[model samples]
Target: AQPQEGEIIGGKEVVPHSRPYMAYLKIKVKDRSGSKPSSCGGFLIRPDAVLSAAHCVLKVTVILGAHNINVQEWSQQRIHVTDWVIHPNYSSASLQNDIALLKLRSRARINENVTFISIPRSNEHVRVGTRCRVAGWGDTSVYGSTTDVMMEVDLKVQNETLCQQEFHDYQRLSMICVGDQNSGKSTYEGDSGGPLVCNKKAHGIVSYGPSGRLLPLVFTRVSYFVPWIRQQLRRFALQELPASPSSQ
Candidate 1:
């Protein structure tokens, strides 16, 4: 499926650089005309790894430690993606297993501004009605202007029954239903591939939403793919290592 871009709707500007784990994705997609510029959100998981939605992957430049994307902030660390691993079972139609890991060409500079976000344990679960936060630098409304600074909104996790009603094809294990339907708060275009943070741990990734920027957007659950994440991260590290020197 052609997934829509995303952003934070009805959100407030977070304290500058407060979310240390936040990653700004500058994507360039080549087409018939030429390469077009676009954006997405991701989070640092390791010194050289960023987690995001698979569909958002393209020719990506990962920016860390930036509040306003338009500015040349000193805290920013821009790096190109050398490699990436998308879930093998990701289904475009259903948006299942939308997670991806981007391997940076070099390790991120760890400091006061840039850091990694924790992930939920393999068996951990976020209860329904739990309030969580999602952030991005996308538009504030449908066809609205994109913001300069990063924005975030607090949304409550909805029950599976309600989620099933909104989305007939909801996947209980791999996907999650988030956002408040009545509050007018949501993730809009430019926000896809961002992290859904709960209790400071990454729980979901922005995947897809309805055409109208409808409520109860779907996210790729993180906990369900913990094993895959670990495996990929380790494999990438292994590949980056130089081959063992010949023994005497």
Candidate 2:
């Protein structure tokens, strides 16, 4: 489907791609009118939780499903967020430590179509040149706005040495680099907080701009933040609802 206004699309053509891995994240920020729906791409990590870039949750509302921007089909199972937790160290100017967790008011109904992606275990390594997939409802073209239909792009992990040199002063252990300068495929502004997956498991969260003279897509490595993530999960556990029979 072609992306409509305030939607993310990959150019004009509607390419055939998989949609299940991409979660439609609808966020309603404070003071946002219902008509101006703010959305980003995210992936499910736990039964009732989602992992996205910290910046995406700035005063937000979340919606799962609904890949087409023009339609609200996925609204049927909306997960209203009761809490948003941004990384304690996140800084807006540098966009560092840009990670966050969303706590849903209730558990999501899981089925074949709705499931969670595994988070990378601590110390899990995805080396340079590893082929990975990134999906999001972000703007396809630079000048064009965001798209409604979720888009996918194939990427190769870049060597850390090269990435550091390219990003200059801002790169760190928390981030992973991916994308191709010649491939004509890349991530845009609204694509922040999306996932970069491999083997159906989430390896990173889209975080920073790409490297070199031109910005490339940088993802925050999930494994590197496992300790911090565990702490957040533990903190949220205090308010978690008992697992439903279906979840067990």
Candidate 3:
């Protein structure tokens, strides 16, 4: 968890191409020495926009229509985004406001193998205990090798009060606490920047968790940022925004 690489360790393989909106990311994070390649997951929200975690944004290449990322499957569409926007108030220290939107250089050609997921309406809310699932490719056990095949795990939304006690910085209005308290069987966090889908809508975004081990996961509550998302989407649709921000 120490801000080192984080991905899921184990999950059930999802049917290939079943989650058409999935976006596999290849990222290079530059440091004083150089950079290192990292991976994360995301989801298509529009023909030209993808939603992901702010911390995961960088020199990113997105692969859509991917099931087996290891193989250049026929359905894949690799793309570089035209723009990236990390929430203005994003914080590395606290991991607050950890959401971002990316505009594609080219509109995605939607098909059975590629499409977009629905974002919640402004101010809409998901209830505690609501069942949801997160999907990605790299969920595995510690010391387990990363798997290229997409995988997913089912989870349930938890009470905010518990999260408040566990994470001193927890913000109920902006973040969601997820995992199963009974089984602790669903602390899936590898799909950072991936969607927390509930009833077919993306209600949350994979965000930071405890640095080293699996605990209940936290997600950026997408409902709280619907206004901002819509504003950015309008700009992306109108082509009126200034130059995109970098690795921001």
lDDT-best of 1 and 3: 1
Badly placed stretches (over 4 Å) of model 3 are 1-10, 31-34, 182-184, 187-189, 240-248
Q: Model 3: number of clashes?
A: 11
Per-residue lDDT value at 114 in model 1: 99
Q: What is the lDDT of residue 144 in candidate 2?
A: 59
Q: Which regions of candidate 2 fall more than 4 Å away from where they truly are?
A: 1-21, 29-36, 74-76, 210-215, 241-248
lDDT top scorer: 1
Worst ten in a row by lDDT for model 2: 1-10
Candidates in descending TM-score order: 1, 3, 2
TM-score per candidate: 0.92, 0.82, 0.89
Q: lDDT tens digits, residues 1-248, model 2?
A: 22233323222322433444456676655564454557677777776678898878855555555556567564335767888788899887777788888887777776655667888888687888888877777776656565656677777787776667666645657888776655556667667778888777789898767432224567888888888877777666755544422222
**Per-residue C-alpha lDDT of model 1 across residues 1-248, encoded as one tens digit per residue:** 12222336777889998899999999998888988999999999988999999988989999999999999999999999999988998877877789899999999999889999999988588988899999898777776767888999898888877778777668888888887776778887788988999988999999877666468788889999998988888788678665743221
Residue 27 Cα positional deviation in candidate 2, in Å, after optimal superposition: 2.8
